[model samples]
Target: MTDGDLDATDPRTLPGFFDALADGKLLGGVCTDCGQVLLPPRPACYACGSRAVDVEPQSREGTVFSYTEVHTPPPAFAADAPYTVAVVELADGGRLLGRVAADYSDVAIGDSVELTVHEPTAAEREVALDYETDWPVHIFEPR
Candidate 1:
């Protein structure tokens, strides 16, 4: 399907997100009712319960709102046992949870970051995103 056909309501919607990711594009679901934007497109508007939504393009830069270093990873991520994850505030005011593309010791809550997309190895995907993803995963590196 085409990017124009990406639907937040489809059962394959999450996979469609990967499709966009593979294309070096980031997508967010914008609620028509409450004007809220969410990453990893949800089925309905969290604010106003609107099923009417639009698939929107997202900015590539953001600031970290919160972050944590993971030292003890699960088996899937044992290969890269230590990493940093961050809650980033996207330019559109949407927050995304993603790997911080930096050493764990360097990440901070207020750091400015820009997007980097990676088509990771199976192990790296699991380590970074907690998913053995088939498409590129998003990372935020210090700007």
Candidate 2:
């Protein structure tokens, strides 16, 4: 689905998540019941299944937990074919999935990475912008 605009105030949804991303911040939901941090920022905590949660900013620094190459992406993202997706473990203790912009050969487990926002090309913006700022996608790069 295409998300043209994001709401920065509501971190429990994708709109808020992307809103935070555009503002140069990564966000997570903290479980009030079990104290577990949700990287994707869900309304309910996955561990304890509690709705009592708090939204907070996440550290931009993270270690590469895992990675894989996407040789054939869906049509909407075919322009970014052969890109790499990596699971980064945030310094505060949670995992986040993000697209890696660097070469696949340059990425490795345990590599250091930092959150970065990427703007789509003019063609991409004209076709289908994912969010505000003419389609800004969240990504990570080797730091």
Top of the candidates by lDDT: 2
Deviating ranges (above 4 Å) for candidate 1:
1-12, 124-133
Could you estimate the TM-score for every candidate? 0.83, 0.80
Query: Could you tell me which 10 consecutive residues in candidate 2 have the lowest summed lDDT?
Result: 1-10
Expressed as tens digits, the lDDT of each residue in 14-106 for candidate 1 is: 877777877888888898888898787767778887777787988988999999888898887777658889999999978998888798788
Give lDDT tens digits, candidate 2, residues 1-143.
33333355577787677767767878888888898999878777889878777888888889999999999888867887899999999898888888987889999999999878876667567667355444366788799
Q: What residue pairs are clashing in model 2?
A: none
- Model 1 TM-score on a 0 to 1 scale: 0.83
Worst 10 residues of 1 by lDDT: 1-10
